[model samples]
Target: MPAFDLPRRLVAEALGTCLLVATVVGSGVMADTLTDDTALALLGNTLATGAILVVLITVFGPMSGAHFNPAVSLVFALKRDLPRRDLGFYVAAQIAGGIAGTMAAHLMFDLPVIEVSLKARTGGSQWFSEWVATFGLVGVILAGLRFDGKAIPWLVGLYITAAYWFTASTSFANPAVALARSLTNTFSGIRPLDLPGFVIAELLGALCALALMGWLLRQPANNTYSAARHS
Candidate 1:
């Protein structure tokens, strides 16, 4: 197991989680009020999400690995960058922080119950569309992770921008993010009952990301930590 700067990691995770919820839920709620079209709401959520990912990665990558996604954290553990036992700690902190962040957003906005989630689901998308959108998201994250950390925020931003415009599902690939978004009852919400299906699709997308990274990065791919950029 690798040693971590625990205080730094926790603080970074807390800030990142808060911002993620704020961006998603805030934008979603605002967009719904600004426009009657659902497309406008999605556009707002997507743009806010992309911008936040870039900002969060730049700010928090040094302190806590900047893995706002549980799937990413788990995959990094599989790749030996993270300790197996520590997975529990990281995930617990992330989920708790995410929920807290969402709740705070709810308090701030006085959100309604129905409009508060970022979970993946069908509107016009079929299951395969959901799968492809998530795969695209994972694909972007894998590419970002396997490459220069300095480029991560921008690359991720570009990926998010692309995913939003290209995919039918609007690319909600993360469960924690979904859960936080779900808390706001805004344009980003998905029904609570539909969570399981979204989770399965996200995991599948993350698996695809791992495989794609394996083929794409193609270097011994084990415990390989190049110098990660902090800022």
Candidate 2:
């Protein structure tokens, strides 16, 4: 059980997610405004998002495990690391916080508070990319927990940094963030219509990672290991 109460944990999750989404959207808007070069803008956005993930996870991990993504929360619940009953609440808090972050970013940039994105992000290739991105993210988290738990923040941050460049979808491995991004018709936005494919792909990816990592990280029984060692 966590040292923090449910309310406190929920607050941490919401606040962390809020700040994360704000950084993602704000940096993208700022970068787009400053440059006509699409790649440069994406690079700026990626750096800000990755840097903020490290900070947020470092600060909030102790409180709520810093799960700003529903896919991640679901994985923990499946692994029995998080209470199954709290899964819904955690996901709700994350999604609400993410939307608030989008609004906060819009306010900072003098844009409308709520706008439906028309950015076309649909396609089979992009859906597959989302699956790959989320699979890698969950795998990284699970492996980091297994070895070098203290380095989880850095591991996740660096993984996302690389994923942003390698994945076609810019590694929106987070379903909450993807949903929030749909509310902003800005540089970081994805079309609301395109969300279903991404969300399904991400969820499937996380589940697959959980299954694979569970088997890979399991320890052998004492007798089995002893016999194997002796033989």
Candidate 3:
């Protein structure tokens, strides 16, 4: 139904990721400038990021499945919806797009194109928060596919909105996002040195979601294999 070649799909992925990160970093910078209250700044960032996600996903879902996050793409690849051969390319595109998005945001804010984040976000609590955030995100995505494919954009948007407040790390659940944020020394930025912990936690969370969803969505009479085979 959503017909598009790999080239088109790749382009869509890159473009969507770029816009998504731009929305994130740009909103954070603006919010911080407008308000001294941390909560208020986060609130603005959350709303803008969630709003942009809904728009981007709705617009690009047909074009490339709208996988702006590498973690999401990894989940789909594990589920076999995405080809193994394309996974590396997808991740590469997402990372590149993320950097480009950060640059765009910087340009808009009249800041340096690439400033390494000095804001330190690390430790057990932060790592655990990332795990939970990414886990919930992937879970929502998988569940949406089964129950309401049309509402996935809204579902993801809402989830991230909540996660931003609830999680200690402000839910930088996507590897590309975390990496790009490291390049921005702003309200939403994270230290580059802390990337490994967050990324590892995110990957673990995504894998856990895949395994759990596989079981949760298993056929009544048969295993998940039957459901996948039929789908």
Candidate 4:
């Protein structure tokens, strides 16, 4: 059972996601405005995202496990760590909070609150990148939980920081974040038309991670022959 009740947990999820998306979008906007070099702007955006993730997870992990992504929530539900009954509620909260975060960023930048993104981010390579990014993210999370739970924040933050540079899609591994980014026509935005492909790839990648990590993390049975020989 969770230390906090469902309502409080939901609040934590919503608030954490809200702040996370705000950082993502806001940082991208600020970086874009400050520099014309795409790589430098992306570096700035990545740093803020990775930094905020560490802070958000540390603050909210105890309350709601700090799953600000639907793919993450779904993976936990599949692992039976999170209640299946609450998965929908958690996803809803995450998506809502994510959209709100985009709007908040827009308001801060004096832009339209819900401008649909026209940034083209669709392609086979892009979809493949999403899969690879999400797969690594879920794998890292599960492995961190199995070994060093306390280090999960840093693990995830660093993984994403690296993934942003390594992946072709800039690693929009979170479905909620992908959807929210679709509503913004800023530096971080993705076209609404490209949303489904990213979301589907992310979900598939997460499930694949769950399957592989589930088997990999299980304890191996003792070998009777080896024990007998030692004896």
The candidate maximizing lDDT is 2
Over 4 Å off in model 2, which ranges? none
Best by TM-score: 2
In angstroms, the error of model 3 at 223 is 13
C-alpha RMSD between model 2 and the true structure: 1.0
lDDT of every model, 2 decimals: 0.71, 0.96, 0.93, 0.96
TM-scores, one per candidate? 0.82, 0.97, 0.94, 0.97
Off by over 4 Å in 3: 222-231
What's model 3's lDDT at 145? Answer: 92
lDDT of 3 by residue, 7-124 (tens): 8888888899999999999999999999999989999999999999999999999888998889999988877898878899889988999999999999999999999999999999
* Candidate 4, position 111, lDDT: 96
lDDT of 2 by residue, 1-231 (tens): 469999999999999999999999999999999999999999999999999999999999999999999999999998899999999999999999999999999999999999999899999989999999999999999999998989999999999999999999999999999999999999999999999999999999999999999999998899999999999
Better of 1 and 2 by lDDT: 2
Show the lowest summed lDDT stretch of 10 residues, model 2: 1-10
| Candidate 1 local lDDT, 158-224, one digit each (tens) | 7876777676656666677766665655666776666667667777777777787778877753444
lDDT of 4 by residue, 7-122 (tens): 99999999999999999999999999999999999999999999999999999999999999999999999889999999999999999999999999999999999999999999
- Mark the 10 consecutive residues where model 4 has the least summed lDDT: 219-228
Pairs that collide in candidate 3 are: none
lDDT of 3: 0.93
Q: How good is model 3 by TM-score?
A: 0.94
